[model samples]
Target: MSRKVIVTCALTGAGDTTSRSEHVPVSPAQIAADAIAAARAGASVVHIHVRDIATGQGSRDVALYREVVRQVKESDVDPVINLTAGMGGDLFIDPSNPTVHLPGTDLVSGLERLAHVEELRPEICTIDCGSLNFGEGSQLYISTPDMLREGAARIRELGVKPEMEIFDTGNLWFANVMVEEGLIAPPPLYQLCMGIPYGAPADPGLLKVMVNMLPQGAEWTSFGIGRNQLPWVEHSVRLGGHVRVGLEDNLYLSKGVKATNAQLTERAISIVESMGHTVATPDEAREILKLDKVASA
Candidate 1:
């Protein structure tokens, strides 16, 4: 076990989970409150993804992001806010037509995608390196090389730390290429997303392979969705990487047990401590991620 680890709470994901858990924050106020609660429960960072209130679906709207960021910052909780720039890249292609997009496809330009990050200027923002066949079938989260480079360049220009999100080995390769091209800043931040079907599995062996592929001295945190959440928390920290947890990834504390964001974060903290590792506080995480102490927004 490492001496110290940082726990991040992914408050509410863009997933279809509003109906699954009563604790999943739908409104901006609820999202912010859940984030603050996660911080109070021992998370040093809160990874956020805002949703449309009426529909309770994922969105890439700048106004939604602004509201969420504002509320989290204004709250007494000082957990490092990490916004998701992963939206606006969905490509549910028309299989029959092969050229046209399906109903759910929501592809936008790299500039449009990063507009929220540019506006909010959070401590950290995610830049998905490449696209992949998401889920079991019929959906694809498309992020081309040109688009990835453009997103990375924009994040670098805005002076916001880009948390390079790697879903598979190719994404990692593209990230390394970005590091070489100077699109990504030095000592980069990474989030190894595992076990989302068609991408890397949540297996410990696969996690190790991905961790080994990271550039030397890179700071990374890893998380798996659903059942893999808690197990990967221990897997990440044991491999000298940090951990992320919360309702966005998994809804249960145990069998049929609905968990709030704070409950998940608290559980991750316990795992970290049980391994003889200390979970980083907000201040410690700030220094570790090289984040600005104050938000520019």
Candidate 2:
């Protein structure tokens, strides 16, 4: 049987892309509006990251999250909401003095990071499974084992599916461990993130290996950054995993063509259909992922 692919549009990311792309949604209203558009364009899920309205930088403020969630839920189209709990884990150390933290540092306890999630009660939320060097700096994205267990447990307690964001093989390892330890519920959802700085490189061989390492019966999705975005959509579907796309991963739809969340989602749907697989609806996605139906507003 041909598989049903779930297309998740990462509406806005906590990156510096707002300045680079005119379509990146910065405000809560824009993010929610774009999410609805993506859903109408055939995305079953919408991954969200709220930004500071004044600066267009990633923010973990609960108020911003509340507004975004509110607007998305109130909209006519109902896509599965996947709020990111990956913020508040960034640690940027001073290059000269390693002991001193830099301005970009925003470390917080695990529960604190999920403040919005606990309140909003979205059907799904992301939990970075491990730490990484992050990018071209003294910066690190920390998610220790203890932190992962705590966050996973909290998400489960709230009856929310935790989408484990695996940046590398080691992160996948820990995610499997979380599943084994009963922190992550059955049919764990993993997001095999690729082409992000020093983490897992966007190679077919690496993705194959990562997919093989996943717990049996796990639901997985994959994406690559920049130019690799669309290619990875076909790659993930061919590999029997779902796909993610949007301005968050790539600013351009084609070379020099800036894209919006809706456009990216439409492109993903086209790729899935071209491969003879139907794109899953939000209801079908809920059934596939074994998530509870979201209540209407």
Model 1 root mean square deviation, Cα atoms: 2.0
lDDT (Cα, tens digit) per residue for candidate 2, span 1-297: 588999999988999998898899999999999999999998999999999999999999999999998998898999999999999999999889888999989999998999999899988999999999988979999899999898888888889999999999999988998899998776799999999988999998999999999878999999999999999999999889999999888999999899989999999899999999999999999999888622221
Candidate 2 residues lying further than 4 Å off, grouped into runs, are 293-297
How many Å off is the CA of 222 in candidate 2? Answer: 0.4
Off by over 4 Å in 1: 293-297
Poorest lDDT segment (10 consecutive residues) of candidate 2? 288-297
Largest lDDT belongs to which candidate? 2
Question: lDDT for model 2, on a 0 to 1 scale?
Answer: 0.92
Local distance difference test, each candidate: 0.86, 0.92
**Every model's TM-score:** 0.96, 0.97
Clash totals in order: 0, 0
Count: clashes, candidate 1: 0
